[model samples]
Target: MGSQSIESGPIPACELMPASILISWHPPTTADVTVETVPPEVVEGENVLLLINSLPKNIVALAWYKGVHNMSHVLALYSLKYDISVTGLAHSGRETMYRNGSLLIQNFTRKDNGFYTLRTINSRGEYVSKTTTHVQVYTTLWMCEHPSISGKLTVESVPPSVAEGASVMLLVHHLPPNLLGFSWYRGVFLSEVREVSRYTMPLNLSMRAPAHSGRETLYSNGSLLLQNVTWKDIGFYTLQTLTTDLKNEVLHVQLEVETSFSTCCNSLTSAPVMIERVPRNVAVGGSILLLVHNAPDLQTFSWYKSMEKIDKFKIAEYSRAMNSMTWGPEQTRRQKVYTNGSMLLQDVTEKDAGFYTLQTLSRDLKIEVTRVQLHVYKPVRNPFIQATSNIVAVQSSVVITCFSQDTGISVHWFFNNQTLQLTKSMKLSPTKCRLTIDPVRREDAGDYQCEASNPISSKKSMPLSLIVLAF
Candidate 1:
């Protein structure tokens, strides 16, 4: 076999093998096509000077495949490359001066995969091979150091129930070999760092939003460790090896939380209080019901709205027929008898607006202070509308809002007694419900009102007369 010297190029950093590059080629029909290679393993993000040497006259156009096929032969789009003088089938320069083709790749991604088959089809039918390399970038910049389970994982103290407050500490790792750390994210963004030497697992010691709590694990070497075990701690944790793109192993840890310290404080032993839900004011057509929760067992619950005590049997009958019975919620107008535990005011008009009390008779137990609020709203008159400017120019915007006294209601907006369009500028926010006309003109002045409604009844604010100003 005849051959010529090829130029050597620089190497990439993310590649393994330290200093050895893998090169392969096939023989073409002509013996004149002799090929040689210089530097094979080029450092990623660096420039490469590929020297493809061939017989004086056999240098053909350059062809480059950004990525080469591995044993499995999955075509990775990320594994593509570029060549400077790439034409259909022509060479830039020929023969004597070994063509110095500048093979530079930029902004490499994991998909930039690799390069190979740097060939020169020489005149003598014998092709020459320069250098080929397999390139892969770490998907993650960091890894876990002794990644362990978070503490909020619960058990039966319930084999598995997410705890109210707990966090798992994980040691993060950043290395060339442990670059794949997708597990830490679990397809979601993590609040922790990715590639640190150590990290604490997720922990939510605060029980503010318990339902939002979740589980995850940290893994290194072969073991999956868990931390802050709760009854919810009993579950399967998979240790996925990014190098293999599959689950290498799984860990099952069981943990539980016992009945923590008990005290008369916040415990059931405290004389429980009974509080009811009743609006202080109702519109011309509205209703109200009394509700008392967290009541101590057998504590006689009494309902008194405007000084009248409710009857117990009436509440029982109400319960039997209610779509769903709740402390005699079934009591209808026909039953007419209000129960001591519950009382319902139907089709409430302005006359029915007043303070309703849920009197608790832990009278025998008498140790806890129990009280709640009932603010009913009865519109003294139809809502009146107001605006900053009645004749605002077409290009100017205006704000319209509703105001009312304690109607015991969180209102939603309505147009012509139907649901109004909810948009960024026209909808109600937590602090205030407002309506804004992006550009008001003479035509926009009209009747508008805010209706506040709740589970029981609805009320509408007085209509505001709007008058738009035209420029």
Candidate 2:
């Protein structure tokens, strides 16, 4: 068999070229393959290197010797260098490596995890394999994925309230390579890792709140839990993660709690009222409660247009303990109108008017129920504005799209509110909320709004204002 010139520095073309890389014409009747270790078993802070064959006849693979890692599991890595007889050597993050059937060792790192596996395949079906290596790094290090704690955690360093004298259970989830010991901190300063009577998988720490104590215990898992929590248990706690391979990652834990019998203006107290649109072309109509669950004693029931209640549905009473609400004034006159904090008029005609609001009395505060605008029959979807490029000149195709968060959006192209004549550029693609404008001119730049709705609700997105600037 013949051979080719081997280059140094850059990886040779053979190793990375796939199946063809191992193909050598000279079939091995019998060949000698040797594996050697450069620096052998390593300690921290060291570099190791090794050489393959002297003759070097298409050397296929180089790898590391392996052993048990983390006292569990086996892993193999291959990153062989096939340059100038050097090939098939893998790296474990600048540490131990398997190079060309030779063991190449280096300084130990915390990330030198798992066992090492190296494989080699020659063109003639000859291959070498090495597996089973143990990796030992120093120190326990951990990090929380995304727990932002840059600025102030709480208002100030005011000690958070605790359970006065209850057991304060603190937990920390650790994923350390060489997890050793850990310490706790209150605020940013180092505090002792309180030894609790209970111990869990990660770290379970507990302590009795010192009477009127203004201290919050920080854990290794980057979390803070205040037990027997009180007003004083209000400040911020910091959890610092320590490891041998890296600097500590400090995480902030903010503590907050709402007192019982609290009052809120618009959150949780209100029902979920959402506009469900089909495609701006195909619309469906319906209505949902504005306020979900609030004070049971909903004494005043009112509907308003703008800010004034329509007085259409007389006052109603709701009782949470009673598990029901009473809205009187017979469901008459408006057939499609339902008084459940929201009223939907189906098969909506252009005559359908403006926004309606529902208000109720709860938690001692008179909060409006929900609001909805009765839109006339109109369809709108996503609007597409296409030009030659960002620098759109005259004679550009402008497409307006109409999409309904609700349904049945019959698109009506409007220049302002007045309808525009349907031209070739203003073609209507039925059931689709897409609009197209072509042969654009500076004159075509104006206010264009898409109206999308379903049988249930009608809505409009912010109008698109076309701006054409001459360069």
Q: Give the number of the best model, judged by lDDT.
A: 2
The C-alpha lDDT values of all candidates are 0.36, 0.39
Candidate 2 lDDT: 0.39
Residue 468's lDDT in candidate 2: 44
lDDT of 2 by residue, 37-59 (tens): 23332234545443333224554
Error of 1 at 225 (Å): 28
Candidate 1: where are CA atoms >4 Å away? 1-381, 414-418, 422-430, 441-446, 453-457, 465-471
**Per-prediction TM-score, please?**
0.25, 0.20
Give lDDT tens digits, candidate 1, residues 1-471: 111222212222112111112233454433222222222222334333334333334343333444343312211111112221212111112212223433434443444543433433332323444334333332221111111322222111122223434543332223124323333221111233321122222331112111223343434422223445443332123222233343232112222233232221365554234444445334456666654444534344443342224544223322222323234433445223243345556775554444344454443555332332233444432332334433345556666655433333355556545566644434343424446677555555566677655434556776656655443
lDDT value, residue 291 of candidate 2: 31
